[model samples]
Target: MKVVETVSGIRETLANMRTAPGKRLKVGFVPTMGYLHEGHQSLLSKAKAECDIVVLSIFVNPLQFGPNEDFDKYPRDSERDLRLAEQSGCDVVFMPSVQEMYPNPIRTSVSVKGVTERLCGASRPGHFDGVAAVVLKLFHIVQPDKAYFGLKDAQQVAVISQMVSDLNVPVDIVPCPILREADGLAMSSRNVYLSAEERREALVLSKALGMAERLAQEEGLTFEALRNKIEGEIRSTPLADIDYIEVLSYPELEPVDPSMETVSRTSDMIVALAVKFGKTRLIDNVILHRK
Candidate 1:
């Protein structure tokens, strides 16, 4: 596996890789903030299975973090990440510095509407703007045929998909499933910050999601009731500080009123939530399929 830290180096390396004996190479890209784990591995494995070459970009984008957020405190393990990258079928690893990524002051950005009005966007103002901007920059830098993202950040997946569709970017956005820990907690880089007890308590997120999914399967369960039940489940844990619990129409994320109580079995939906355990915040969701 080749690890390139400079933007020019990655572009040059990928450019070289794009040239084969007789066929055009298919490239799959996975953009992440480093601290590789099972979730990231899953993305790389999927990319490898689908493409001729796989590139992994690791840069903890300051743009994605709020002013008060843990940009500085986010975990980093370059040596370990490199080992994991190669093991997970990543061909080239793009680990750029902040200065390398943003050499000049960034005056322009990309944004998606509607999807950004709630959840992480509402809680952390300008968060998705940072995500969209950085993602766009990376997409330009990497220029892969397809990019993979985990559904753990379903809203992010939605926002990026919207950006890609509206901008007509040539890359295909592949949304992968969320990988959870053995016990149930959703995997996240921020999860490392959780204390031993906080980590254990965090299981409520997956448990709540499970219950919500089963409850929502019922033909008459209202979105509001499902959301409230989720909130209550998480609240039952003393350490789980609630951020938001919402049930919305799938990729659209449109809010459905409680009065329209009987959810259509044919309508696809999602129940997503963000809760803080100690200083660490985690997000998890389940997509309800059309019955």
Candidate 2:
């Protein structure tokens, strides 16, 4: 129920908690923007269960949004978000202002090299750099033993994992399953941007991934054939424009060779996609393992 707004305040609070009595603090952290949903709650709930204390940070990082992206218009409801966090068993909410986070100009940033150049990175330009910078900042600020992220942002997950490994950050990165609506659309704060008709069209992203999964499992299609089928479905939709439909190695995120026979034998493949519905961009993915 406690809300700390400054980085120093959060660090001080955690330091105080560390020395309190006989309790050994096992901190679980979930970093997110201020719009609470089932997806965000899922991570918080899992964190609460696994750790003695759960900390959730709700800061809409400006660094992560592109010049044309919706950093300003991104949905935010801190009051509701706090209630949801409390209900989900969070111990503290770290809600820092932009000034508190970046009082001075930022000079440094983190990037994951090769994986940062593919898929979403190819389209968004400095997107992954922004993500890496902000996430590293959060990891340092919270310094949780374990941190949770939704698998819905598979590329983000992949990028974070790379950053953690390469930089040797002392935190466990855990990726939870994608939380979805009743009709199967993945839950997102930006989902509010969808007009009724565009909302219906948006489901195509998940449907396309579903088709790719089926082809991979039942039809025994090659990765090339599977990708083509998925792309063809997106192209058929009038309202959906494809950003990228990639089947890549899970952790490293390198593209899988369509001609390689070992593609079917690999257990860690990710079918990830990003699509534009009107002015809004949404992402979704499915992880596949050969059975």
Provide TM-scores for the models: 0.98, 0.96
Identify the leading candidate in terms of TM-score. 1
Tens digit of lDDT per residue, candidate 2, span 224-247? 878888999999989998888888
Error of 2 at 51 (Å): 0.4
Local distance difference test scores for all models: 0.90, 0.88
- Cα lDDT of model 1 by residue, 1-291, tens digit: 999989889999999999998999999999999999999999999999999999999999998888899999899999999999999989999999999988898999777899999888899999999999999999999999999999999999999999999999999999999999899888898888988999889998899889977786677776777778888888889998888888888899887776675655568888888888888888899998877
- What root-mean-square deviation over C-alphas does model 2 reach? 1.5
Residue 64's lDDT within candidate 2 is 82
**Candidate whose lDDT is highest:** 1
**Candidate 2 clash pair list:** none
Query: What overall lDDT, based on C-alpha atoms, would model 1 receive against the true structure?
Result: 0.90
Residue 76, model 2: lDDT of 89
